[model samples]
Target: MAKTAKKIGSSAERLLKVTEALCAEHGLESVSMRDIAKAAGVSPSVIYHHYESRIDLLMAVFRQRFGMLLALRAPLVAELEAQAVPDVDKFLYSIMAPIAFMRSKGEDGAMASRFIARALMSSLPEIKAEVDAGIRGMRETVDIAQRAFPHLSREEICWRLHFTFGVEHMTHWDNERLEIMSDGLCNARSVEESITRAVAFAKAAFLAP
Candidate 1:
């Protein structure tokens, strides 16, 4: 019994480490339980003992990242409600505020942002459901839209959200391309510029008749 329990504990730690490494090297979709087990130096069955399926494991991966983002967004809630700053642009800045901060936090945080951006772009239903559940304000913006722009319908409101999201996802790019494209040329390297462009474009597009 003692030996078996020790083995289980060891397997759990390995699984966690493997999960982190996978996130760092590749996003959630590219990993497999067998790959995780090999990275952890444990047998493949060990992962099954802990997770029912690979999707569950991937959920665990993005769940942690989602949690991190949510926590980062929490503080802005009060400001959001206060309407301290006029217009939806402030709200957009608040929502993306945390993600921009991740830029200076080194590779792990940066990669998390990239991985998350990629996941949202994919066609996987699991990913879509998880994102819907994870990013509450993503859809909550509908309320703001309705209140701010009564001329728009429920369907039009949804379109604005999609447009906003599409602009955000456009930031996900190849680092190689970025370096080549912007080495000496003008490009928005700072997070502030990217956010400004996205927020401005979204507001203009949504507010336009």
Candidate 2:
């Protein structure tokens, strides 16, 4: 039974890796179960055996990538919640730092980041629902934001948080654009700098009236 479980885990991991690469290279909607099977050198039936449908496979990939991110941020987030005075900068950093850490992990990490980027931008109902469900977990962050900015309405805080998602996503996805636009004067590859700038930028945006 242990051996069987190990084999199942390995196969699922292989399928996820192949699916992530294909989805990253050729957007989420463009990839099919057959395409994933071909890339992974498995049969389509095997893919179906592991996942109920294309959306299920995609959600698994989404959960897999974001699960790492949530794990990284969980401790930091808990620390913020424990603080008597919420440090907006630290709160923002807690969110962006994990993404920067992921982006610094080389090609595999980049593929994961790309998959996340595609998932965030996907308009499919299934994808959106998953994303919304994930965002609901941010209630703690929202509570922190409310405490930090008492004057802001919950609606406004939610909107700013949504905007923060855009900034965080772009910082990872189109980071190279900054370097190109800056003519090498700026370094987009520096994870520390990226986190610092993203946190500072988001902090200001959140504080804006």
- Candidate with top TM-score is 2
Residues 1-209, model 1: lDDT tens digits: 99999987777656665676675567666777788877877677778898788777767767777788777876665566666333676766665567766643687777677666666654567978887675575555566566656788989888777777666656434333555787846355567666787678877887889
Lowest lDDT 10-mer window, candidate 2? 95-104
C-alpha positional error of residue 44 in candidate 2 after TM-score superposition, expressed in Å: 1.2
Task: Quote each prediction's TM-score.
Answer: 0.74, 0.91
Which digits, one per residue and each the tens of the lDDT, describe model 2 over residues 68-179? 8788888888888898878888888887888888878898887888888888888878988988898888898899888878899999999998899788877878988998
Clashes of each: 0, 0
Which residue pairs clash in candidate 2?
Answer: none
Write down the TM-score for model 1: 0.74
lDDT of each: 0.68, 0.88
